[model samples]
Target: MAQAKKQSSIKVKVQKFGTALSGMIMPNIGAIIAWGLTAAFFMYPHGWFPNKEINNLVNPMLRFLLPLLIGYTGGKMVDDDRGAVAGAIGTLGVIVGTDQPMFLGAMIMGPLSAWLLKKLDQVFQDKIKSGFEMIYNNFSLGILGMIMAIFAYFIIGPVMEVGSQWASAGVNAIIRVHLLPLANIIIEPAKVLFLNNAIGNGILVPLGIQQAAQVGKSVLFLMESNPGPGLGILLAFTLFGKGKSKSSAPGAAIIEFFGGVHEIYFPYVLMKPSLILAAIGGGVTGTFLFTTLGGGLKAAASPGSILAILLVSAKDAYFGNIVGVLGAAVVSFIIAAIILKHDKSTGEDLDAKQKEMQAMKAESKGQAMPEAEDAHESVKSYENVKKVIFACDAGMGSSAMGASLLRDKFKKAGIDVSVTNTAVRNLKDEDGLLVVTQEELADRSLQKTPHAMHVAVGNFLSSPKYDTIVASFKALTQVEDKPKQEKPVKKVGSIDGIDFSKVKEVNFIRHDQHLGTATMATSLFSDAMKKAGKTTPVKAVRINELTDDPSHLVIVTPAANKNLAVRYSDIQTLVVKNLLQDKKLNEAVEKLN
Candidate 1:
């Protein structure tokens, strides 16, 4: 029975792995469509819209909007509002930091951010209680969301950018300064173990491109036809794989090599870390073979899969490709077999460590303790403690931003409150602590504290929604304040002579890659508007100076389309869209429109 249970567990794990892998690939379906469309227009200039104009519009839209949409949707599916907000913020971070277009950044960062946020939320969710909800629901949650966004922007974004650049540079330097054989020997190992595709393409190909072009060959042709790390993995499996896993190894290698899904081998490698060296050895061998055989590819072969290589390789390099693939496979198999002979079980230790960590977390959060203790504590000091503390991954960026925003809102409403930012782990004893985070981070220790409240802020801090939160807190606290009447706004005219009554309002989606606050707002507004049967164009605009002109409107026309330029002057009202500032003008425009 125990043996059967273990097999069942392994089967379940495999099933989950397959499902996740499939899901990850599904997004690429849309990505391929976008890539194909863009490639067609770039390659065939006379096919559709004017090449230059189409290029300009399509690039920005794909880079920014498409990724944002996909990420937001994915996040929503994962963790609802909070995940959606995090996805949007992560997409913005990628856009601001990378020189690459938004589409690629979004593709990578959106899911990554969502995953991080979800994980963080799970780690901190249980420590909050209902009494503290007054504060948790008010400002603490938003503050936490902001902190997470900032962490992603400053830490993750820059590291990825620098890493890509450095890897590319290092690869090129090796190939240029050393002999082709020596260079391959070094690069192959790095690619196999570290899975550094950026280094391979960014550095290796540029050198190969220049070398091939100089020698009267197409740069693209050389890159496309080249066999890469995939071949190395295959070689290792062919020689080393034996017994029950032998057949699985060759099949897995072929899938990884040809399908360009490098992750397929991760389980195998994880099961035996010594395979790292073996894979590296194979990689170096393959690289040497590739250079010697004059193997090259025209385009990048992501996943280094055999199929991707074949698709991108030059027509005449078929023999060179086969030789390189076989060479890498043989070398890797020998290395892996030698390494695996000395390998031991590492999963048992890892499982033990995971359990230990969970226990520690439970203790720290007070979940393992009794409920009566918490009830007794809450009753002891129910009236005197009036403060709420907000904790996040980092106290600097989002926490600070959120705290400041909430502070202003609370002050404006004449609600007296105190708030501070602290790392989640640093949170200590407080009278009425409200722990605001994703559901994942709620701790039982937080609940046992008697006055603690856990409110999940999903992600992304909206000032308007937070204002309502402050209002709720004020009501709960019985703070006395007179309500102010809504101010009347001057009516603005529209150019189309369409009934002003039909137009609801004009709003701007301001974003600068640091925080996608604008995109989140726009998405919310659009969703709300669509529900109400409203339609409006969301235009992109550049804001040069904050104080340039409150009344000045700048109209941007498509390139070489002077005929459309005069249309702006003919309109009575201008709805400007700047993805930077959150202001009353947006509301006014929305209302007027």
Candidate 2:
């Protein structure tokens, strides 16, 4: 047990580090895609239609714009807007002396520079005079940015270039040994463990960008982003798995293959850990085919969707890329099928496994398992929520898809709230914000935005949590839009006929079918009475349990009141339209002794 905990701790540390690395690159994927399209369609000789004017964007974007944006974002992740400027300033230092894109350097300098500035401010900020604050802030940032830039230009740039070369050399060595495909042994498992962003955006993308700069295309972009293996696993579940896992696989497959939300299929693998072997087999097969057929992509596919893969595919490598995805799918499906066929378990309880997976995921992110018991405990938090954000490890993939779905739901329901998607690291703590994230990422989301209400979903595509959010907001809009009356009408004679001074105990009679409602109504009314400073006791009991006494006040429906009148003549009763919400019942609680 101790060893297991130690290993889990190490995994969490690695995941956190990876998440930080990916947080820098993932937000700038759009810029990366723009550079890729320019390179693929307009670069001289290699591009489909070379244009010197359009191609001008290719090199500058790769070297200056991309790295600086990454650095700025990385710094923002560490220390907000001030850090972002500092990070960008420091990143320019590395770009000055190198022909290669300094992604690694940007990653290091952006956060480091911002963090340094933040620390410095912590010491001097309180000591600054009130009137000179603006001048101090400006000059401090300027001086620090300048120093960091010079340091990066001289020290970090050349160092990162050598490090980048060594990394490239190591990958080339693996290719020479014909063991490049074996990388799946690590990539496949890392992905299921929710470290996909770290492995893909953080590591593979930078390498792919460097390789593409040299040769116009790189298979490294496809290594971790490939959707084939996950697709295969879903297809196998659709055919051979049992219970909910089997039924949910078809939709999950669509999301994985076409929609590019690979996270939708992770629960299936978690439900059956043995399926990871299939993922490995499929990944190895795909990489081998990609390598053998000279398949390469011009840029990383953010979601790893088949469409995105084809869109960014090198002009000449279409067939190779298609074959690689298909081959991997076929190989993965076969292995998964064999494993499912040989299973001896009665029926896999996917719901339990899913919850277990969520628990494990929460544990890894350094939080206790989330409880549904409190899902509605803080309904008031949703009242002023002006917007909703769907967050995931990488904001571009699963969260984007989930956000789109929720946005549509909100539109149809006439909910005017804004809906958006972003990486969890980018979530901010502010008023009027509601965050929805995958259960695995809930802890991180909470940490980033403790002021915001959070909802964790097991499946992004079709979690009931989305409907709950829609319903809650829909009710809020109705309440807000409702016009008020000039004068409030008080319930007078409805409860005036009852002699509430004689009542010492209030009872809600429970029936076989209505026991739950009766219990809930009694509890609510009890709280309302106490809040009004009444000392009356309240209880829910069976019809036969009521005593024949005026001291017991029975709140019942019209039908139940008739039965109560037949049962006992001395019992006092008030017929209410609703067991819990009737205005008459609320007024009576105020008069209770």
Candidate 3:
């Protein structure tokens, strides 16, 4: 059910291009690693069986299998099944023409071939007749695949070979001279900007695994995986930061250092963009030390976790790796602290912005609900209410905290209700349950659990609405809505101290309010009464339209605008609280003839 995430940022095309590159490589990394391991164990100069038979498997794997896999992955990204087929076919030409393995060539042509076919389909797709659709699909792909294969062999394969060799030479020269520190210029900024996941997991890890297999270790493993930069930044905040950041920095540091959740520190750096210098300084310092000491690991330390790194350490370089990490952290922390002190950004603004972000983040998952009122109200009884639940996307973080806060509030109020948190997807319709979520998600939550009373808040952490809800719970015990007999009671059907019956028309009045809760509630209640065989017209009118007419039953919506209602209360009147609840609505309607 996971759709491709929409990317709208124009700063770089990385979300599309970088993500596609990562997607193509990640799925086949296991196979690539398997080939590398096979070569190391059975076909290398140090292999037990260094014979021609072992060498035979190696060449075919490098030339045919690897390139085809890359091509298939690349093509699939562009145009699914047909793209994969075309990519594989085009890559075969590269495999045939080149004595050397066409790694780079396969990557380029795979997605390129897929993209080319996708364009062809876009052009011919509308023209193809319904009955001949299958034939068109098959023949078009076949012809295009043949064309790309021929083109790859004659044109692209040779040119890519030279380019790959040149890139390789440049990289080797940089590594040899220990100018690898220069890489931090790009790496540090990318990591801070959240592009590190693609750079590390997609590109570096697979290549690192290949290198590690042949030489028993690879410095490439440490390039993007070093956690020192983020760790240093978080540590700096923990020691010398200001405002909400100072309070939050310790928790962020613990998670980043021990849990390897580097994203915890991203917001802190983003608060002050100049802090990127701290990251780069740390990255360069760590990488330089790692390169100088020839520090590496036997495998990719995924998560860039220090514990994962230590567990996969290459022999004779463990101490050097540890020393490099420490050096990076200390240097980054010092620079970050200086930058933080010099920057004059206000803490209150950051705190407010952070809260806004949290609210906005939850809001993005849903849309505003229709304000149109429902004619048939199905209000769930709170008489036997046993539990309340807070529901959200993941259920573990914000929802859980909201549930806990509500639970604490209930305890203080002496309410014997059980409160819990759950994922929205896990909700089941049940009686005596209350479902609370952000207002934006309220509609979805109601759809999932219509039997439960749905409550919504603009924010979960702190809101005044919870207090109003608790007061409502107290009133639940005192009020009992039932069909009335002949005898009339004083102040009956009172909502915020206004009641009405035995009037010619229930005139709904709003001064300047547009189509909202007032308009909706009036339309629905009026329609319902008309359906129930009541002859009295339910009229909508403006405040200025009303006269000193005692025949009219005037009611106001949001009923909090009591000042407006007081202006015309001489006649029968009802001030509807926030909404038209079924119980209160029934009492007022049933009281009529």
Q: What is candidate 1's lDDT per residue for 1-593, written digit by digit as tens?
A: 45643653453344333323223323343453344345334423432333765556544554565556655655654555566677677767765666643333444555666676767655643343313323332344355446645765677667766765664466555555534444444444433332233334334443333333223222222232234444454445456554434445576556556655453454355445567665666566665666666665533445456776665454455566667767776776677766655545432332233234335444544454222223234433222335545554323333454566667777888867676665443454544455443222234225333345444332213223354456456555554437879875543332343344543333332223412443444455555556656565332222311122223332221221132232222222433343333353345344543
The candidate with the higher lDDT, 2 or 3, is 2
Better of 1 and 2 by lDDT: 2
Model 2 CA lDDT for position 410: 85
Against the hidden reference, what TM-scores do the models get?
0.34, 0.73, 0.54
- List, residue by residue over 19-113, the lDDT tens digit for candidate 2: 99998988899999999999999998689999988888889999999999999999998877788999999999999957778999999999999
What range of 10 consecutive residues in model 1 has the weakest lDDT sum? 540-549
Task: Give per-residue CA lDDT, model 3, range 507-540, as digits (tens).
Answer: 6663334424545666677767867777766655
What residue pairs clash in candidate 3, if any at all?
none
Compared with the true structure, model 1 gives a TM-score of: 0.34
Backbone Cα, N, C clashes tallied per candidate: 65, 0, 0
Error of 3 at 404 (Å): 16
lDDT of 1: 0.46
